[model samples]
Target: MNAKELHDKTPDQLREELASLKKESFNLRFQQATGQLENAAKIRAARRNAARVKTVLNQKAAAAATDAE
Candidate 1:
């Protein structure tokens, strides 16, 4: 997913998506180890998407913490 799309997601939704991506990454890694992975680019895409979600989550958390201060 793109950064703009990721940023538009609610915090909870981002978290859920991140969790799903991580699970998918794990499976992708297993596939690669077994020489069954057809799309190597998918692993990179998943990593970037997971990072974007994490960045959004961290940004939201920081904003909330600052607001609470």
Candidate 2:
């Protein structure tokens, strides 16, 4: 998913999405280790997607903190 999509989600939803992405990344790694992974590039994509979610989450948190101040 893209940052634009992630940005539209609430923090709780973003967190859930991050959790699923992390799980998928773990599974992808396991498959790679066992030589069952068909596409190595998927690992990279999953990581980047997770990172995007994380970035958006952080940005939201920062904005909230600034507003609170």
Candidate with top TM-score is: 2
Model 2 CA lDDT for position 65: 100
- Tens digit of per-residue lDDT, candidate 1, span 1-69: 688998788999998999999999999999999999999999999999898899889999999999999
Candidate 2 lDDT by residue in tens digits, 12-53: 999999999999999999999999999999999999999999
Cα shift from native, residue 18, model 1 (Å): 0.5
Each prediction's whole-model lDDT (CA): 0.93, 0.96
What's each prediction's TM-score? 0.91, 0.98
Cα deviation at 62, candidate 1, in Å, is: 0.7
